[model samples]
Target: MFWSKKNGNKSQEFQEILKLRSELSFKGIQFDKALFQLLTPLFEENPLLFKDWKDLQNKVLQAVEEKTWTIQDEIEFIESYVNLWKIAKSDELHTQLTIKGNQQDIQIFPLITFGAIQNALQLGYNSMREHPLKIRIQLSQSTLQLEVSNRVNHYLQNQADNMQFEYWKNRLEYRYPEKHQLFVNSNSNIFKSTLILQIA
Candidate 1:
């Protein structure tokens, strides 16, 4: 069959993708990096049928079955992804950046990205309600800049008491190698961290 036909076996492919998506969704699985990496081979053979969320879910499940990826495995993957995105989105940068000197030509540190995200989440919180922090993301050509500035009671100096923050920072370094930059500062009663990421 000609690859350009876009008809032959298309129905079967869609069925397989749909079936995979349904199974994973029922299993409450989130297709994340670890799962993807573990299942790349299965997907490599079949190729991706669709890029839609539903399609991706199916691809993920297909990989899981072939690679024996467990739900716990997917959970860990999601935990990391959520942590990264959550912090990057919520924390805000100190608006009036005081550049003391020239733009220091420093190698970007990935841990900084994780740190920046962690800092933002910590800074933006209110006990009055549940889930008070909100994070926003913007990606540009050269950098994936994240702003996580949230309204909270604590200041920059006092927010480091929690162990989770430290743990996350370490995890960031483990994941990013040397491809990230993190800047954290506060102004006008808001705690924020900016993560500038150089995509590899």
Candidate 2:
């Protein structure tokens, strides 16, 4: 009787292990499918995506090495990224940009700012229903700010968006430590993100 119970326990353990492996395999397949869906549009429509990204990467590296980066450079990058979205979803996405302030010589981490803008664009695009997406950029001697807003059919706020905003916040904290302040807030109807870098 003891031997039979021990064998049964071993069989149960083996079954549990098999079940865990099957679960992991199913999750892996789900992840792959999600990734394929996310990338299919870029592959099918925007064959130039890689080339454009490479060019932008080079420009960013050059700016960082030369220390000649400006706000306009960042604006252009954002415009290009928005343009890609426009090309991809021309009828679904509408964008308006308003840039204010005259300070253009302020040095900054263009990539970090770009990441923040990308997050903003994602939030805006996802929330935009029938209204146009609006982006406002303000530059000053001491601060730079960007505000993105749009209307949605339903309020579908996700932690992923907040996490993206926090990703940049943590990055800024690590890089600027004491010289920067990052704030991101969302509402039932509108999503807004603001980044202020203190350049004295």
Candidate 3:
């Protein structure tokens, strides 16, 4: 809703959104049954809940019902994930997403970026008092590159160094074998991770 109001949607892009929205609405988790019956009435009072429901379908629940993921979906998922926390702690954030290359052509795993983003928010001060959080993405050829940087507390520095992010490593290896690389590193005031995924 806010996206359309803020940026006038081109005819093609608008139609694409409407079409995907329609498919996702009708394709999975029938509202006629148990889960729907439990949550229907609350939707009217809590608008954000409704929004989360849709995002949950696209960003999470769809793993069972769908096999395809567009770059736009990934971008929106990242934005939505951050915005929830940002809304609650707006003053504590100095974060931004810097995207490059062609978003439309890249195919990515939904929620693949979640682990890195979560760690950034947790390990970093993420406020005016510290250096800003950097969420950067770039696509070149058949590979996708992601890097997240944060300013963290000195006492918690050990925790940052110990993070293995094995979930991501295992998944990426299973999907792309040696084609992908994932790792995390930190120095005194900054902690960061870099992931290069081949997602052709």
Most TM-score-accurate candidate: 3
Residue lDDT tens for model 1, 24-110: 332332333433443444443544412332354554445532233332333333344444333333343222111121222333322
Each prediction's whole-model lDDT (CA): 0.43, 0.57, 0.63
Model 1 segments more than 4 A misplaced = 1-123, 126-134, 155-157
**Model 3, residue 113: displacement in angstroms?**
2.1
lDDT of 2 by residue, 1-200 (tens): 45688899997886565445433332332122332344456765666764765465455445542133677777786676667656556467777888999855776655546444555445554424456677787888887776666653243555234544444555565555688766656656655556677755
Per-residue lDDT value at 88 in model 1: 33
Candidate order (lDDT): 3, 2, 1
TM-score of 3: 0.66
Show where candidate 3 strays beyond 4 Å: 1-59, 64-68, 160-164
Cα RMSD for candidate 1?
19.6
Candidate with more favorable, higher lDDT: 1 or 3: 3
